[model samples]
Target: MTLKEIVDKLGATVGLGADKLDREEEYCFASDLMSDVLTLKDTPVLVTGLCNVQTIRTCDMANLEVVIFVRGKRPTEDMVELADENDMILICTPYSMFKTCGILYGAGMKPLY
Candidate 1:
């Protein structure tokens, strides 16, 4: 799914990098554990409930771009700045991780498996 579609479908708040909305994400990975996230390939969209600088750092280390912060958890200013520096896309959704994953999956977004 496209970033714009995910945002619209999930009714997410685009916390950062609206300019990067045109990018397409083929796979989705839901995990609060940064260690698990490190194993992802294809720069899959991260569906997470954890919002912190470490989240941004994990994304950076994994070379991922798009992130969906579930349950309305948003990144801090410093995290946003770091993401901006890394050219990452940030989104916050009010839905739980399961709901968000279901929504995106129903929208034709594939799994990271």
Candidate 2:
């Protein structure tokens, strides 16, 4: 699914990188554990609730492009700045992590495992 589609479906707000919404992703990884996230190989959309600087840093290390913050978690300025520097897309969704995962999966987004 396109990042735009995910945003529309989840009624999420774009915190940054709106221009990059056209990016396509078939897989998604939902986790708050940064260590677990680092294990991902495919460049899937990261669905995480851990809205911290480390999240952005981990994405940078993993070279992931898009991140959806679930349960209405918003990014801090530092986090946004770091993500902006990395040219990554930041999305905020009001739904819980489980609902976010289910919605994306129901919409044909594959899971990492």
Candidate 3:
């Protein structure tokens, strides 16, 4: 599905603009463990509750295109800058990790299993 669709479906607030949010992401992986995230294959969209700079770094390392920070967590300015520099999209949602995953999954975002 498209990133815009995912944002709308999940009621997420995107931090980036049209240039960044206008992309398609088919796979999604939800986790707080950066090490586990490093094991992923393609650049799947990520749903993470870890509100740290490393979260964004991990996404960069994995070539992830988007990151949804669950539970109302927002990334630091440094993280945002790095994400922008890396051409990554950042989204924030008030939903918990479980609800975030459920909402995206229900919207047809395949799990990165």
What does candidate 1's lDDT look like per residue over 36-107, in tens digits?
A: 998776688889998999999999999988899999897899999999999899999999999998988898
- Summarize candidate 3's per-residue lDDT along 1-113 as a digit string, tens digits: 88888888878898754566668888898889999999988778889899888988888888887889999998888988988898888899889999989988888889867
| Residue ranges of candidate 2 with Cα displaced over 4 Å | none
lDDT, model 1: 0.90
- Which 10 residues in a row give candidate 2 its minimum summed lDDT? 36-45
Ranking by lDDT: 2, 1, 3
User: What TM-score quantifies how close candidate 1 is to the native fold?
Assistant: 0.96
Whichever of 1 and 3 has more lDDT, that candidate is 1
Indicate the residue-level lDDT of 21 in model 1.
87
Candidate number that wins on lDDT, 2 or 3 = 2
For residues 4-87, write the lDDT of model 2, one tens digit per residue: 999999999999998888888898898999998888887888999999999999999999989999999999999999999999
TM-score of each: 0.96, 0.96, 0.93
The prediction achieving the highest lDDT against the true structure is: 2
TM-score of 2: 0.96
Residue 31: error of model 1 in Å?
A: 0.3
Model 1: colliding residue pairs: none
